[model samples]
Target: MFDQDKDTGGLQGKVILITGGTSGLGAQCVLRLALNNASHIYFTGRNTKKGSAIIKETHDAGCTTPLTFVECDLTKLASVKAAADKILSEQHRLDLLMANAGVMNQPPGLTADGYEVQFGTNFLSHALLIQKFLPLMDKTAELPGSDVRIVQLTSTGFRGAPSGGIRFDDLKTVQNFRVLGGMMRYGQSKLAAVLYAQELARRHPNIISVSVTPGIVSTELVSKQNAFHRSTIWLSAKITQGRIYSPKEAPASQLWCAVGPRNEIKQGAFYEPVGILSKITTKYTQDEDLAWRLWDWTQSELKQWLD
Candidate 1:
């Protein structure tokens, strides 16, 4: 039997980057990676106070893993570029890039770049970060036995997206914006994330590019919802058998994707719950044509900023 408590010890000396690492699942991932002795970690968030606290706690626990906090507001593309540039300047290679920062349902709004809130934060910003960091990841992959990886944090909420999938025409929700449409919008963003990972894996066979869902975890994700929405979720959970994982348990799948045996997990696969390979519950997620279309659309969207 595989020892559930055994340490595999793979992250030592690795340089890792995690977005939205200030709290929740991202924070858990940071702790795990640090405990495994990653040489350096660059985590992005807007809260310096919280970031400092996480850093202090890690050091207090006798972890020598150097942690650097980059103040990145994922809602702003400019901030994303600045954070990526800072990492590029300091690190010759990034062994792992976990695009873990995301927001759930929120009142209709636009990002600093005018994209929908959920789509911009959960998908587009992450897409840009991966593009900016690919050169460094590719350089690291050239090393023998190096597991240079890009892990996108997706969710089961993706199953809630529209049947046709990825409303490319109205990603901004300009035509039909509903206050309660946040759930579907969140799902769409996550689906885009999965497709982005699939397309990336196809384009770059040498590196590991995959998305993962942690299942439902009890976290601050629910705190943002209004009272009615929150109550509805609580009631729905009671109606169905919903497994809510703890923060520690939630990050396990992503941690596995980041450092587990490369041969055990396929590139571009959508992994779920405690490190198992599982396809998302949607054919659109695996649609190669749709994946390429998303890729092309994303590239064109980022062209102005990328240039």
Candidate 2:
């Protein structure tokens, strides 16, 4: 199931931008991209020390490639926009934009914008990112046989997430604040992630936009979660029929989405577990209304930055 040309060899000379590349799944993505000999890999994170260290690690891993680290606090919309603008100043083409930076199940926390931390970091931050990079994504195919990619990392808990539907009205969930509520809300955010990708691809036909479940790999994503959540990670590692992958395993599905050769897969399709891209689960795939509504609401929220 591995092709050198489609994934390994072809990755050379591609320019990829990944958010939250300093840790967890994002760190894995950095290593994979470096190994693939990508011409340039630009990633951002808030942890300055860790960010620098990861970049050094990429070079030390024998990438011998250019790695740029932008200090970005995704909690701040202004920061996200400014980072995108910076990239746009120097680069016109962004071959792969993996929205892999997301807060897993977290306790109640607030961002600089005063929005719920999970939704802001996981969904809205990414939404604003796509808006800013929308132009770059559309121009991917202009580079002659170049197919740019946008991969969103969602979760298996998407459908069952949230108390009742993805509440567009109460994204912050000020009315209720239970641990499970937040966890479900986090899933709701992931659900919105694919739905947002769906809406984006529908609007922009030039880019190959997709969402994938990274198959529950062990990473710092658990540390952001509760004890039970952390235990769930351990339990999955122990007893699951499928192999519980490490943080490194997190990026293969991502790199596949970015660089894998697939003959078919309609733009905006949601994929789960590796190169297996399918639009399963009617609860999510069938909800066009929810998707558009989410897009509209998110745009409205980020109107100032968009302006």
Candidate 3:
């Protein structure tokens, strides 16, 4: 699995940004792209030691392109912008983006930006990142090999959200707050991820925007949460025989979604299980107008961070 492909230069010459690079699924993306001969690899995370260590390890393992680390807490819009600006200052080209970092505990906290933990980190941050970084989306509208992409990482667990749809009246879910409140709230946040992807796909027409599930990955991210999340996962993993994927395996879908063949995959497609194009939730597929509104609302909410 670690060997380089001689025939398909799948990610060659691409400048890619992945959000949660310190551990888990995102780190796996860092490894896969490094070996695939990508021209530049930049990822964002809050851990200075681990982030720098991953960069060193990538170099030791032999990467042809420059490997970089940008520290940004996905929970904060200001931080995301700082990271994007850092990328712009450092390089002129950006070929792919994996909006993959998030926190999942059922506990409710607010980001520095003052949104709920679930919504702020997972939803608004990714939305803001894309809007601010739109300039680097590569201006090709019709040309083949013009690879520009935004891949959103959502979850099957999103289906478990009580809302089962975008809860427009309670985007933050602060009034009905409980542990279950967080369950639905987290799911609601991921809906924003998927809906955001859908919105970008429709509006841009050319950029390859899609959402994907990483299949359950066994990573340190799971352990970072409070007792509530860890207990639920522990119970779930036991019932499923604890087969959550290793971070390395989890990146299979995300990496493919970013660089996989466009003709084979659909635009605005959701993917999982090693490049298999997955389905959008039925409600989302039908609610094109809702996605558009959600996109606009997010822009309005983050207007100050847009610059």
Candidate 4:
């Protein structure tokens, strides 16, 4: 289920950063990357205890990779910047970035940066982090055989996004505000992940930027849902007996895109089902103009963090 013994020369000496690495799929990526010999693995999360446990778990498993923790609260742009700055100070090169931190359906609210919570935490902050860390990434680009990659963990929820995609005017307002609105907002953010990856790949040909859907994994993501949605899932599970992937399986597509052969991945692509270049069936997700508009809007809104 993992490339435990595969030669990791491709990842040797590489510095990797993964957000939301305290639990779930992000945790799996951290361990797997450590096993594969990433020289420095820095994972971000708000929970210091969980962070310490993850570090210890790796060591107990005989992981020799250098592991560090960067305390980051994704809902706050300032926190994200502080974490990035810490990495910039310590790591000379950032070989891979896993934009894996995100929130699912939640009550309407603003991030510390004042944007919608889901959109802000899931997409906006990550977009800024990529911008903030580009210099470090580019430094690695100068090295021979270096594969600088950014993998955005989008979701199947993207297909259910709102009618016109991102609501540019009402970025702060949640129309319904609860279950329905929360899902729509979550979808919008996930769609942004897909579009962001696409636009990033197009703009930076030297680096790899791609999004992947991990396919309905059984994790805390579902546990965050309201009771109504939970009941629906329970009933659906009883009737269809559907396949809910394990947390270990959830990071497969992401790891594949992150460490797979260069030629196998199509740059600017969204992947799914372990490892395949599946197209984003959503029309809005594939809109180049919309992607650029979102990028520009994010930059304009986050001008203070651009430095």
Q: Is candidate 3 or candidate 4 better by lDDT?
A: 4
Candidate 3 lDDT, 154-196, residue by residue in tens: 8766665554366666655452555477677777777777778
Model 4 lDDT tens row, 1-307: 3352352346888999999999999998898888767789999999999999999999999989999988999988899888988889897899999999888887888887678888988999898899999877977878988999999999868877888998888786554544488889999999999998888888788899999987777788788777898776556555543666788866877888888888888888888865667754778977899999998898898789875
Each model's TM-score? 0.93, 0.91, 0.88, 0.93
lDDT of each: 0.84, 0.78, 0.75, 0.84
How good is model 4 by TM-score?
Answer: 0.93
Q: Give the residue spans of candidate 1 off by over 4 A.
A: 1-8, 173-180, 231-242
TM-score of 3: 0.88
Worst 10 residues of 2 by lDDT: 1-10
Superior by TM-score: candidate 2 or candidate 4: 4
Tens digits of per-residue lDDT, candidate 1, 189-290, equal 999999999898999888899999877677888767789877876665555427456777667778778877788878889987667778446888868898
Across residues 1-307, which tens digit of lDDT does each residue of candidate 2 receive? 6442246557776788999998888887787677777778899899989988997887787878788988888889889989988988888788888898887666677778877788889989988888888777677668887878788888766865665557766665432555576677677778888788889888887788889887777676766657777787668656742667777555677777777774565688877656776645646556899888888888889898988
- Residue pairs in collision within model 4: none
- Candidate 2 stretches greater than 4 Å from native: 3-6, 172-179, 233-241, 278-282
RMSD (Cα, Å) for all candidates, in order, is 2.1, 2.4, 3.0, 2.3
Candidate 2: residue pairs that collide? none
After TM-score superposition, the amount by which residue 102's alpha carbon in candidate 4 deviates from its true location, in angstroms, is 1.0
